[model samples]
Target: MTFESHGVSAGCWTGTLQSDRRPASLSVTHRGAVVVQAALREAGPGVWAVSAGLPPSVIDNGVHSLLLVVGDSVLASLTLVAGTVAGDDLLAEVAQLRAELDLLKREFRRLATGG
Candidate 1:
């Protein structure tokens, strides 16, 4: 939720940082390479805005995670997934959630029936 101004979309990422003082540095990295060397600016008192453009190579199918760094600390991240892989991932997650929900419902019914 740090990225308030804009979330990852249109091959770009945006985030916000709130601190009492300005950070020494800010950047975005992918696989340890600096994609955004310095893309931070003070938006208001104790608030800063950061943004970066995602590379085309990392935009392909699979999970793409971008790290947002403030000073030397890894503050936030943006993750994108696409293609059939993304669909499969979502389906697996949904199946797991459904299993858990079914378990909860059964437990609730057993307790309700005083079994």
Candidate 2:
């Protein structure tokens, strides 16, 4: 239902999320790169607990987002949330898309250059 990261901090940070369905797994990232991916466990009716030792790739205090791909469709999504896969995963996905785009751009450049 709520996640709180207290004590001394020097990285990007955000907090708290409420989702409709429980997620089975979570992925974290910052600026579009896969950071942490871990299993989820139900903590309550609608709340799930994130495992400890989140990957270092997770942006601590960044504008992270997440996409929860459930069975066939995406069940939950979060943008501008703290963790990422749970909320940061979306950013990682976006990063993937960007990489694909860059590849396309390179191909176009090569063609234009008469290579």
When summed lDDT is taken over every stretch of 10 residues in candidate 2, the lowest stretch is 5-14
Residues 1-115 of candidate 2: C-alpha lDDT, one tens digit per residue = 3443321134323332345676555554434454445346665666665443334444355554544333333333444435433445666757876896799799889999999
lDDT of 2 at 27: 53
Model 1 over residues 6-115: C-alpha lDDT tens digits? 78768778777778877777777777677775467888888887767777877877766667876656677666677667577767756865896699799889999999
RMSD in angstroms between candidate 2 and the native structure over all alpha carbons = 11.8
Q: What is the TM-score of candidate 2?
A: 0.33
**Candidate 2 residue 1 C-alpha distance from true site, Å:** 9.2
lDDT of prediction 1: 0.72
TM-score of each: 0.62, 0.33
